[model samples]
Target: MRYIYDEQGVTFNYFLLTFIAIFLIPTTYFSLFSTDKDAKLRKPSCNCEACLRKENYLKNRKLSSTDRISKKLAIFVAVGWICFAYLVYKVTTVKIEIDVWDPYEVLGISEGTPLPQIKKHFKELSRKWHPDKAPEDKKAEYESKFIDFTKAYKVLTDEDIRKNYEEWGHPDGKQAYSLGIALPTWLIEAKNSPFVLGVYALAFGIGLPFFVGRWWYSSNAYTKDGIRTHTMDLYFKELRNNSTIKQLLDLLSASVEYKELVEQRPSDTTLLPQIISSVKEELDKRFSEKYQPSKRYIAPYCQKASALFHAHLLRINFSDEDLLKDKYFIAERSIHLINGILDIAIAHRWLQTSLRCMELSQLLVQAMWFQDNSLVQLPYINQDIIKTMKLKKKNIRNIIQLREMNDEERKNVFKALSPTEYESLMRIASIYPLLKIDQAYFKVAGDAIITPGSIVTLIIKLRI
Candidate 1:
């Protein structure tokens, strides 16, 4: 019917709430907004090739589990912190009342008063406040005071009571133990019982299971790489023994993950035609028509993604803001999808297909498409520059071959590039990995002759 609350229990609840808020604030912040510390933004104003590449890198960067936080959780954390602040204010302002029975205070005498002096004082107090001597109207008040005076006197004079008081903080020994709920008193009242039960039912019965079920279902839908199992199955079914780079692009474009990234808008009905027209028109400017999208029926969104990806490989700069943004995110999220395809290829024991997948993954990171001259990876080099130098005539397929050329030949190849541009290009070229094998041999330890079916160790010394 009713519940009692004391400053002790209420203060404990306030402190408990404050403690919970202290931990939840940071936990919620990290869960909702945490990101990679090393992720840097490129200057939006700088449209240089390097800045463009950096922009793509930032957009397409794969998020680790720790780096992915949703904005919805941020709102929850903010509200929680506000409540916590109020709890903290209550804790600081509340006046706690603790019932401490002090013999000296009750008897109105200083501690360590001699027993004779204490007895004399008690006798004076007893005579003055004794109920027999009090007027009828004041008799009850005097009686209560007298009882407390007698108890304090006994605690100071009697050996056993003094010992109990000293040991257990009470003349009669230990007081009854109480388990404070550390919650507001009104929470447990009869009228509030249904509301409290409903909250408990909503949280544990409904909310908890809902969240756990959602997590379990979502986890099962995707592979360990976070690619959907159904998408992986599609990739496996479509992959052939001799799948080409373009085929791999098609597989990547068709992934269901892009559905979430490339969301449709109310204007897409009219906008889709413009996007398709632009994608086709820009792609034609680049000479690589072989990498054009397949004739097979694909979801409109998937087709847009596929076309954008092909344009990306050809280094086609898009004029549409939404298309560019979508392309960047699609490129980023595609990392997991590509890895999923790689896994499927490896499982099927398709070595060529597996290597192609690996190559595509790397190309995705560099924003280069397959069949582009490897020279495009060098700084300040483009299709026009590569054609002007007649690099193909010199058979310089890679930076390594370019590095192998004599000083005169290298100078002639880069003569068109400015001196500063040439220096930057050379600097990037130098960083390319070049493996050199120094020695190779095989032998069995402590054996004069190698025997059939015997394990042999092959030692190779290599430098990069």
Candidate 2:
């Protein structure tokens, strides 16, 4: 007989046994009429004809219906068992719980928590269950508990740790632990002892290589061509060896003492000569070594230093309107230099090259505005040129307004102007005319034009 629960061996065996018993009973009962003595012994006799007839009728009837029902019940039980097993597997294998205490939930702490409170909490907890205070009998248990408590408390209280926890969850701690991330081994040894050093070294010996291997393989560097390229490997090696780029970045940082000094008194001309000379010397040194300037490469750090020197020089000359004109011209030239450097950086495919260039560009733009020369004008300028220049300074709304205007509206704004008014506005728009010497020249030409009512010819010329 075909077993419906064949996939489930135990259930199939049970159904097979039940079917055998049903068939065997009917065979044994009919065996009483058998001529063979062994068959006759296995059967039970019925004297009445009605009993014999009933028995004979049942024996003749087909058992296929009962077998089919049994098969269906076996299949149903097997399916139920399978579903139960799957549910158990899912519950065990895919379970994930986020049980770490959230600082915000427990203590109402958030980004705005005061540093003093954090420090105070750390100190109070550290003192209360310090390992040394535990009784001899419970020292080991207490110390373990205390350690876990302190770790959890420290992570929750610290701003950085709390932020990381919020982002990644408690499992992040286990990952960090497995990765052997912690204070530097040397620092830990100095703070604690050689035992700590030994532990760290052992952990690092196993973890560092694994971590580094995973990173190297997982990153783009793992490609066969990337790995085989000697120049690429050497570039990375040099980057790893040199600290000059970091030092140069540190010097240019907003928090640096030099940066503070320059900001506090921007017009301090005394420092300009020294700064310029130092930067030039560094540039010469780097160039002589055949080191190309790049955002990633250490050699280009001198360029940043040079840019800073020029920025400082611009600052010193910022206040004098005449000097401001000269400074603006210099600033525009500096922008070109910066663009050239960015091209070189891009050629090298320097890491963070675009970001560095953007940062420097922003700094230069900010320095340009420091002198209040935003409205300055220059000699021999055209009004159309001034209008174009104004487009550069316009905010999003102004830009949208300009964009939305029909050609006729744009033309009417600039057409039919007298030569002197056009020239004066042009000069006013130029950076040089804001100089003290040129200031008087602008006043003379200010009212030299009057619109003669929408000159169509002039509008066509301007629009075209």
Candidate 3:
């Protein structure tokens, strides 16, 4: 038997080789079957799982922990208990017995040793072999020895059993006693019923994760690729079909709501820093629970970002002598602000990872992609000392094409793009490939770190 010990010294029996499985096993059919899952709980303003949960909890102020537990965790607990009960029952029923041929030898006592002396040896041995203090790798060995010590202690303590053992030199007339209490007879006797164990094996075996992965992969594939299966042609098609820079150009165009959206913008760069400082002070006062910045500071963070977005984009000048510098200023400033917040969010356990933020960042990088790599490597200009580089309107338009396509006949299409386009895509992918469209391809591309959820969802691919 290969028994293992938890951090608290709770033993997992040798029969159930499920330490990895229990921790890594995905949630079962319940999560897949639920129609209104976290999709409904997601908040529109923020694109993070932690913020979503926090917002949801703040909205439902009246619901208690018990109500939430019953609605959410009850079914999970019940399903998990199925495997727990089976493993426990299997491991505990080892049918151990004290041979009792020599109680003196078992307890390390002489034939006529008094109870006090006998207990002295038992205490010393018990302390040495205690499972809680045993080495992690040698847990099972110590546990087995501890069980023997306990049974020896039990037999030697019982006067009648000791007397019989001493006189008969064996437990010939004694009835065998169990180390632990017997569970209900029905559960133990159900060993004869192959049907019961089969159900257990099926639910907890490799089969369960195999089924769940298929469900998850299929749904995600369809979401990103429509009816297309494993092949991501449809997904890549939609990906390349985007005209993000064109949309931004249209938004900034004089005709459509450009003047309307930029009525009166505020410039409060200090507001965000002040809010962050205030939240930090408040969080410092609390000692019981750790506070995450993202969860605590999201509202104020977004309030500031909304002001900056309009102030910059809406007021952008197409004819500015230093348009590229202005674009870089906006991008770098935005990146720094968000990156600072992201660092704080990641440090806390409550809010560490996000897929949507990564996706949006990647899209922005794509929109900002420059064909001339050397442009990015140019020496930094001293903004206050040097006049901005004057560039022609034709050169600007050549680098930044955002005009809307009329139709398929007139639309600009690039299949197997030229070396320049390919280089641009490679640059963006190298910097930010966080969307993780295909996990296998993600690994091959050298970007395969995935976040774990409340229930560690195991993704298994099966060929039928």
Summed backbone clashes in each candidate are: 0, 5, 1
Highest-scoring model, TM-score? 1
lDDT of 2 by residue, 343-362 (tens): 44566666465456655565
Show where candidate 2 strays beyond 4 Å: 1-98, 101-115, 156-160, 170-464
- Considering TM-score, which of the candidate structures 1 and 3 is the better prediction for this target? 1
In order, candidate lDDTs are: 0.77, 0.44, 0.41
Q: Rank the candidates by TM-score, best first.
A: 1, 3, 2
Q: Model 3 — TM-score against the truth?
A: 0.21
Per-residue error at 356 for model 3, in Å?
Answer: 20
Candidates, ranked, lDDT: 1, 2, 3
Misplaced by over 4 Å in model 1 are: 1-6, 9-14, 17-50, 53-89, 104-149, 176-181, 265-292, 437-462
Local accuracy of candidate 1 as per-residue lDDT tens digits, 278-360: 65664455554433556663787777788667656656664666766787777878877888888878888899999998899
lDDT for 195 (candidate 2): 77
